[model samples]
Target: MITEFGLSELWEPETRRDPHAFYARVRAAGRPVPQVDPAGNRFWVVARHADVLEGLRHPEIGHQLPGLSHGEGEAERIASRQLISLDPPDHTRLRGLVGRAFTARMTARLEPWIAEVADRLVARARELGSFDGVADLADPLPVNVIAQLVGVPEDDRAMFRAWSATIVSASDWDGSATLAFAAYLDDLAALRRRAPADDLLSELVALEAGGDALDRDELVAMIQLLLIAGQETTVDVIVNGIRLLLTHPEQWRNLRDDPSLADAVVEETLRFRGPVEIVPPRFAFRDLDLAGGVIPAHERVALSLWGANRDPEVFADPDVFDVHRSDVRRHIAFGHGIHFCLGASLGRLEARIMFDRVARELGTLRLAADQGDFRLHHGGLPLTL
Candidate 1:
């Protein structure tokens, strides 16, 4: 029995720095590992590769439950009402409206601009000779791109970036960032309602299907979701990829020799050192068998993507970071099913651009800090580049 406290024992700092050791312990434990808090509050963590995949796609699992919430009233509703927390018809309808906004055309149009952003960011990093990749390059790149896409005023982007960063770093316990972002989104949505423009926020504002449109609250939640989800994860992906390449010199060499390997590097990094430590806890819609462990209805269950991705059963020699690994793309870092990340393509494109730019600017990238000196950025995601 992995006590709830034991399974959740990894602190923010330690987990952020190196969670592999911790994950190994959990993986060695029985399926649907039990995690008990001091108060006897327990949750199940699914770490096996097969179980993680099943949990991700299972119809009996979802983000919603009647009484399961972090807090009472409006805050919980705001948190749950967002696309990430929705289920069924609501999820389907909202996904379609938002999906249309991020069409291939929009992505293509954003590519050159994204490349340009990467170039400028790289130049700035190069000028500094040495800089925190997460802060100087990886951090600002996606926020800027998303800002432009949402039509944020040039002068306000700095503030926009700050809020986005704060929210990403803020955990569920700290509701400040969430509240701050919600307030900001409320105002932005109002602006869009009055004067729609060519940007994504405006596009979403005007979007309608079958005579249905996103309500004010829904609009606010979607924009907040996009800014955080669209920008936050990609930052870690790029930062993690660069650091991995530098650490794995051979893989770095492969990428440097053939920049086309950037795509492979992105996929491998997402699998090996994924952005999220675990998928947001999904609730068991009802009693279900998972890895021989039965999860009770409405119980909170989390899938450790980091552990699952490295499951030996799924990937041979899973510990080795290889860009050329034939089965590298099979990792569920971006998730596996209906709730699979909507921003996956955008993230991959951003990471590819980041790697290509790094190779172009810094021929032989080297870590400025000791391997142990790095801190995790997006909740237990180690950051060093």
Candidate 2:
């Protein structure tokens, strides 16, 4: 019998194609594997919806893992300088300062511009007939939007996109790439200091002057995190959602018939094939009970957002991708609690506009070739449409 959370033979191709079915097997056991990895790490996989929620809500489980850094424990280098890296009182203060920048009103105000961008992209896609969704659609839109918000110039978007990619690389850090990125950011900060604009970066600079505290290091970290977070995962959501819909023609038709369903479809797609398959690893601040096991302090806890979203106890027919599912919003695709994604609203808006514009402008959009194989960026999604 396969023990709960037992290491199985499925880890290889599953990482390449789909990990959902594999997670279903573990979830069927109704408990996380007693201990998934070696090193006698006490962490358990939380596959049940209830268990995931419990783990996410637990106060003892914090996001302060010390050993997560690479290359001789570069703790000072990798930790996010933004609000996300901070735990409590500091987190609350920084988040409060930046909350107004991402308000619904502000995002809504950008709708016309976003729609225009979507329309232009869709028109370009039609001209090409077939394009890699990852490169053409999923990758660029969010990068463009976030660049505008952060005061990056139009010509600099390419370099900014490359920098975002390098910083978020799961493999070894590219020294030249990383240093160039850091230097660019330092220059950007100095530019803002010299002549501020009416963007979020400028606003942050002003805030810094007004006693809202964030040093140069913190600012660099915040900029890097925002650049990657604002663009990368969002591109994954759009690409993955499009891939699934194209394969499931019926669901695609459901959205085509009624554009109002696009929002719910976005939510369901996020549940089905979200970009951040797992939540960022967290540290056990103290001994904590999870999934019928005790996780000792100093150990790491990884949350499977993908697994939790598809738990049958919470979602009926969890494996089936259904846009009409009434419980779609219950999914933890955007996560829960204090560390929930800050740019979620912007992501949704981008998705809705992109889907609508694509479906409307490109009347006969479909997969380019059945035999073409696509690549997945570890913990990321890709599509060709």
Q: Residue-wise lDDT of candidate 1 within 1-385, one digit each (tens)?
A: 5434355565546664667766666677666776664565667878888888888888889877877654675556566678878888889988888888877777778999999999998888778777777878888888888888887887888877777767666554556666766687778777887988778887787765346678766776777777888788898888788888888888888888888888999999988888887887678989989976798888878788998889888898999999999998779988877778888888899999999888877775677765543334542222223
lDDT values, one for every candidate: 0.78, 0.73
Report the error of model 2 at residue 102, Å: 3.1
Give the residue spans of candidate 2 off by over 4 A.
Answer: 1-10, 14-16, 34-43, 65-82, 171-175, 371-385
Pick out the ten consecutive residues of candidate 2 with the lowest summed lDDT.
371-380
Whole-model alpha-carbon lDDT for candidate 2: 0.73
Clashes of each: 4, 2
Candidate 1 runs further than 4 Å off: 1-18, 28-30, 37-40, 69-74, 171-180, 208-210, 373-375, 378-385
Over 121-222, each residue of candidate 2 has an lDDT whose tens digit, in order, gives 887877877677777777778999999888898999999988778767743344555557667877987898899986777777777677875676666667
